[model samples]
Target: MTALAATSTPSQDLPSLIERAASMLSGAKTAAEVLEAREVAGLAYDVAKRAARLQRAKSAHDDLVAAAHRAQAHALEIEARAKRRLADEYDAAQARGEVAGHGGGRNFKVANGNVETTTADLGLRRDQIHEARQLRDAEAVDPGIVRRTLDERLEHGEEPSRAALRKMVVDAAMRGMRPQRRASRRNPLYVAPTPEQAAWRHVTGVFRAFAEWASDENLALARKGMREAGDTPFHDLDARAIAQGSAAFTTIKEWFDAR
Candidate 1:
């Protein structure tokens, strides 16, 4: 459905190409299609990255420039799957002794880990492969983290750079020395949330379920009657529960009023 599936070059119009990248990802219905979508997205990210570098010189409005950076961030996020797939394929090849591990990283079959097909033979540098491995490892922990951090930086009016992203990843890794995660958290990268971010996240997370529960049909169901165990509805409103909920709401109202 797209011409860029086989090519790396993207259209000159950054916004239009961003749309295409998004469309490719959404339209993908098969594994092969998904891989192709990653390719297109990677191309979009590359194009947007370059275009954004000149946005200041072009004197674009702040919003427009930020939007472009965000598009780049989104595209890079989509391309993460491609990074994992590439690294996995390389690792499998290394396991099979078809290629050496980049920079002598790992290889089960080959002792020296040197093989016939070099990364150079495949037209990739050691550093590129190493970066791919890093992306793969990080994504395995928390998908879309790179894009999220990039967008976070842009939202704060900071220049988004590879160094910044690397620092974030490294910082998160360093925080690994913290105590083990609670059962609820299962800490992915150990990146701590700011106080404000944590508060907002807690509010949204709680309200999302509360909103669904307060929907019209649910509210009616809650008031209808006690549901039978086997032959009736699963959930029935209890007087004690309702009282607790009312008390909770009042407490929240008071807290907000105090604020």
Candidate 2:
């Protein structure tokens, strides 16, 4: 009991000393124990702080990984948009090439599903108009033929310009037949007024003055009266007789009034 045990080496006794200290600190209650527990608690607090720092670092790493995934997704979307744009440009170029391959004359199918050449259609219409105009111009005959047809129509009560009439004329000409002279007929009149009688109304009072003067009577007034009578074809001889001074002015006036 009196002999003391030899102290163990510091390195060899470290684990045992730490174990005892931990137990003491765990059970500490008094002032000295509380002070020792405080130191132990401070060390434990430092350990907890280090553990919290590690946890926060791991959380930050997880957050960075999620952000990286989102960034990659955004990059993929950008790439997809660029690819679509490129495809659109390529399609547009291909369409342009196809359009260019066709010459200036592009083919179009009509509603009837038939293909027709535009130029040929226009030419056909032009030809139709030309033919119609030629037909009209060709049918326009000489005026001399029209005039003869009109005269024949009036004298014979014939419907002229008939093909039968044309053939008859042609046949007669071929046979050297002489066309007979058509007679001009006169209408009968019940009473034929003398020229001096017809012109009596046309005689001027100025001519009466000339007749009263005898030789001094106005020749000008007599000539004017004759002109007035001659203006009308319905009376003739009486006007000339009055102008020549063959009929008495009073007789001419009476004949004119009677008419």
Candidate 3:
């Protein structure tokens, strides 16, 4: 036997060993060879069971991580919304002189033992929002580090299954969570077409005009010509195809006009 076959653990080479044992059983003529094959096959079964248990453990860990992340994000969102609502309420109270200082301007007293003035309550809410945001941003898993670790594991002859490899790649490509920015309170405005959009519109408009001017027979011919050029109505043609189609339609129109 080679060094690899000698050093390989049953878990790592279970499938190959199983196949070899099956082959040996098929070729066995003596009782001793047949008994050896049976022992190897039984060992392969144990290795397979161990591999499955490891896979299940890995899957459970991943599911727990995913659930933790989702819960963190949901808590952050709720905290942010609560903070905004509290700020709005504080501003409204101040505007109506319900939360003003006892003597004059902005000073206010704490109300109940557990609660305070609107300003102080708002401040507390803001602090809570900041803490929650930080907690949400703190990720336990570093995808880049995970990818490197995966590579090192594979290099050491610890082979991860295909599903595990896919998960590792996906995790490495995922971006870290951060606090979402509040949407700007700006009025919507109409925007003009971009230069690329304008050019494409011009090309398509030329084709449309030709289609409108062409006779029925010529219009049918134009459709056939575009189809022959590999253009499909269900999909938008590329710029080159658009230019070619426009030129073809224009020629067809001119031919019908001359007639």
Candidate 4:
């Protein structure tokens, strides 16, 4: 049995081989037939075990891909926050006039033993701040290239440098910013009046008709009917008022119609 197992052809497609083996097992009758069925069943079992291992490996690879994307997104968020903080600090320093070294007009002792007053170059920090702001805006508008680059670096087990990330952001900006798609506008639900309340419109039309054609005594009777039905004399015709007035309207209309 060991010799036969060792000599059996390696299965290229495990699932197909397993199905064939199952068919063999289902039709076994004699001892020789049963032995052949058992051998096929054993092969199927081995193939199933191999398939499980392959599935696990595929799952692990998928998980790694997901982790890479998450890491990229988190890193970009951190970078954006740091740039914002730096810009804020730079603004505060400028406001306090503490960035004097950035502006011109300072005297320094030269290596040649001569005291020289030279204009200080104060715009370096400001330029850096401007570049940071531009990169941040570009990232906000279209982060696809930056995200892809960072994810690739993470997949390769390399830490992406700040310079590389900034370059990617700039490259994306050069490629033209992609405007974000507007979210689909949904009309808000129109809450219909309750059935009882909605019936009040018919009731009010009847009241208006009675005011024009009916006698004062009949109109007084209608008002009394409305009060009895829980409607205020000067109801605002809101949901509750409509609900209360529905019964009064029905009673007045029926009396007038009968007359």
Candidate 5:
């Protein structure tokens, strides 16, 4: 209460002495005003506590946001894995013939009833859009138009094979050389003819069949030839061995031509 010692004038003491004295005074005053100062300091401490808690909460929120992003990335990875697995399963199932059409040739209808196809399996998105245009245009024509147009276009061609001509004459009699007329013709007897006549007859029958088939525009001739080559008498013959045995007489054509 000595007027707080004139509050110590700045010029009254040396700088070091003044600093030391100021520290001693502050310590002494804090002890004397302990309760009052404690209340005020407590308020500041409370403010710091709240600020620290707010900082911690902000940090925790940032961590949660980061975790959410990581979870989202994981979900995308899982989705990609599922898509690849489904694609592989689809390919395996197709190989085993569980689905219809050529093994890898058709569009896929997914489990969700959505149509999706790989670029390799069918058209890409852009290609599908283009093909859709063709389909839309074709749908405008009659269903039978393509076949009818082809038949009419080939009507004047030379008569092809029996199997072929039959296709061309879609509505006509099944057999040509009318049945009654063929019956009256002189029939060749089973008795052996000259070798020249025998070979000629066989050759004539083959040529006639080929001509008729070609004229009729029958598309199955190549398949029929391959099928016949694999069956019965022709397949059993050692065509390969025969070719290897003689160089000058090599190959099916050479063997037949040499004879």
Candidate 6:
């Protein structure tokens, strides 16, 4: 990460940060430089998102919010490009016998030459390489899906949330469809939801829906059914069962706490 990426506080200088990262990635002479540029781009995206949220909360001008979102979209493009670079470099490294891993991939064991840095030496994970390739291929197939998703949200008065995009990707993957690609546009940038992002949307969606369904009255009736015999087994929410605390409350609380 560079000094630009170290920006912990929200600043309007996200454009500069993104520009620097793009320059670094384009001019990168080494894999490390690509990684650094990606890191900065990631930071730029995060900071711009926060700024957009802050502006919305303060009821600032709509233009300000839209500009921040545009910054985020651009930053994502740079990050995707970096991923492509890293993927290509990893392939080249494998050919040069510069990548050492536990299992053979693309090639059999080339006698370990202690002469140069390996994939492990540079702290590159096999998973990252695969994910980078996925992003690159996704762009080839779908064109400007990454930026278009964000810009669409801005135009539609949505929050421009990354979670929403991840959810779309997961859903698309489930249905064996490419994610939200239009034939009219094309661009080099792309993103595919990681397992972590997919899992997040899954867990949060489950919790949200469950919380609404498991209201006090509903739980109370279910409790009655599980408890005493023909005691109507149903009642309205007087807040009685919830206020006094019951087996159903304890069970739900425990499950929620575990989560």
Residue-pair clashes per prediction, in order, are 0, 5, 0, 3, 4, 0
Q: C-alpha displacement of 153 in model 5, angstroms?
A: 68
* 136-246 per-residue lDDT for model 3 (tens digits): 232212212333443454445343332443344345345534322333346245454565765556556656755577999988887885565353221232334368667
Candidate 5 regions exceeding 4 Å error are 1-61, 97-105, 109-259
The digit string of per-residue lDDT tens for model 1 on 1-259 reads 5456445464345545655665666675433344566667767787767767778789988755765676676566666655556566666767776565444433323223354334443344567566666766564445446766886887697666657766766665665522232433555556656658655565555567578768898777755633422232111213344586688768877888999
Model 2 lDDT per residue over 1-259, tens place: 1001122333323223223333544464332332343333223323333433554567766433332222222222222222223223223433545212222232212223354323232122334333322222221211123234434543453322224334543554455443222332353434444546534423554465445755634666767755764543212324443465655656767777999
Looking at candidate 6, what is the lDDT of residue 20?
A: 72
Q: Identify the leading candidate in terms of TM-score.
A: 6
lDDT of each: 0.59, 0.35, 0.42, 0.47, 0.35, 0.64
- Candidate 3, residue 61: Cα displacement in angstroms equals 1.7
Per-residue accuracy of model 6 over 136-174 as CA lDDT, tens digit each: 545444555555676687668766665755654555456
Score candidate 5 by TM-score against the native: 0.18
Local error of candidate 5 at residue 100 (angstroms):
10
Q: Any residue pairs clashing in model 1, and if so which?
A: none
Clashes of 5: 4
Q: After superposing candidate 2, which stretches have Cα over 4 Å from the reference?
A: 1-60, 98-259
State the lDDT of candidate 4 residue by residue for 1-259, as single tens digits. Answer: 5322543447334334433443444454322333344455445444444443564567756434333333333334334434543344444544555444453233322223353323232123446566655654564454334556665765575544456677776676678663333432453454545646545654554557546767888778867866653442112222343576677767766878999
- Residue 213, candidate 6: C-alpha displacement in angstroms: 45
Ranked by lDDT, the better of candidates 2 and 4 is 4
Instruction: Tell me which of candidates 1 and 4 scores higher on TM-score.
Output: 1
